[model samples]
Target: MLILVTNDDGVRSPGLRALALSLGEIGRVVVVAPDRNRSAIGHALTLDHPLRAEEIKPDVFAVDGTPTDCVNLGIHGLLSQRPDLVVSGINCGLNVGDDISYSGTVCAALEATLMGLPAFAISLDTSLFSHADLSVSTRFAKKLAVDIMEKGLPEETFLNINVPFGPCSGVELTTQGKRNYGESVVVKEDPRGRKYYWIGGTENGFEDLPGSDCNAVHRGYISVTPLRTNMTNDKTYAVMQQRSFACMGDID
Candidate 1:
């Protein structure tokens, strides 16, 4: 099976390399990623400017774009054959709770899922960026990938997996959780006396929500949250239909 591998942590990130190599044991692996770190870029696509891609090695390419661009380009242009699966990340940090909305890592997987391929986003729950020996996580990813290759996933569904640092208790199926942040954006003056803002914050709380991805990670369990493409609010849609604001017999 052909497997497309990409990440937001950049091409040279050890997590990305390790994941690619681990997946190679099971299938043909191709790596296409950003040349530099593109963390928290979400699902941004490059349309304002021309995108650039370079083949640094066989089956490995670096693109001057976000993770979403990598997946979009890799599938539509780079790969000679369509990939059976797309495994994004093994990212440097966890993408739990509301963080998924801002995560380029998860966005890469989502891009693949949009193209009708089974995809998964894996992240290590560590604060340190240098922590790269993610053998355990890679193994877990390989196993899950194998299962997906055989059984396939539900339509429009992708898996978000977060691996806790150190010994993991086990895996748990979970739902997305709400994450509250405090002092996230900080303003500081640079050496040039210009004000610069840093966008980051510490996790405030998850309310210890049961069966939530954040709660599982906090409890040292590997959180597997199934995500889908549809974002429709059925209840709101029904309410709006009942309200009937539109004039049915207009244009007399």
Candidate 2:
């Protein structure tokens, strides 16, 4: 089996390297990632500017674009053979709740799913960016990758795995966490009298909703959430269809 790997934290990210190294043991692994950190970039594609990709080593390339670009380019242009699975991240920080919407890490994996391949996005939950041995997370990622390789995924579905910091006891199938990101964005002025913004805040630990990814992590457990490509709220759609805006009798 062939596996394609990419991340939003750029080619040099330790998490990216750890994931690639572990995946290499199971199958042919190729790494294609952005040249610079593209965190929270979402699923953006480079259209206006010309995207440049430089091959840094055998089976490893870096693109001057988003995480989505790297994955798209990997399957379409770089890889000599189409990959059976696409795995993204081992992201430095957590991507739970609404974080998935703005995560380039998840976007790379999602792009691969769009191209008809099983995909996964993995992240490590940590507050500080420090050197941590990723052996445990890498091992877990490899196991999951092999599982997908053996079992295969359902149509139009992808997996989002978030590993908690420190030793993990086991995996818990989870749902997207509820995040109360209070006053998250901070507006500021620079020394040159320029307006700037910093995205910063502590995650609210309080949520009545249990069995969420964030809650799981808060309790020190690895969270594995299955995500579907279809965003339609079937229950809500059914209810909305019954309510009509058209008038039955109107004066002409």
Candidates' TM-scores?
Answer: 0.93, 0.93
Give the CA lDDT, 0 to 100, for residue 248 in model 2.
52
Each model's lDDT comes to 0.91, 0.89
lDDT of 2 by residue, 1-252 (tens): 899999999999989998999999999999999999999999999999888889899888999999999998999988889999999998999898888999999988899988899999999986544656677789999999989988999999999988888877777899997777788888889999999987865444436468888888777788999988888999999998999857855746
User: Which regions of candidate 1 deviate over 4 angstroms?
Assistant: 191-193, 247-252
Minimum summed lDDT over a 10-residue window in model 1 is located at 198-207
Candidate 2 residue runs with Cα over 4 Å from true position? 127-129, 192-194, 201-208, 245-252
Once model 1 is optimally superposed onto the true structure by TM-score, how far is the C-alpha of residue 79 displaced, in angstroms?
0.6
lDDT of 1: 0.91
- Residue clash pairs of candidate 2: none
Model 1: how far is 220 from its true place, Å?
Answer: 0.7
Mind giving the per-residue lDDT tens digits that candidate 1 earns over 84-200? 999998899889889899999998989888889999999998766575458789999999999999899999999999998988899999999878777788898999999998788
User: For candidate 2, what is the TM-score?
Assistant: 0.93
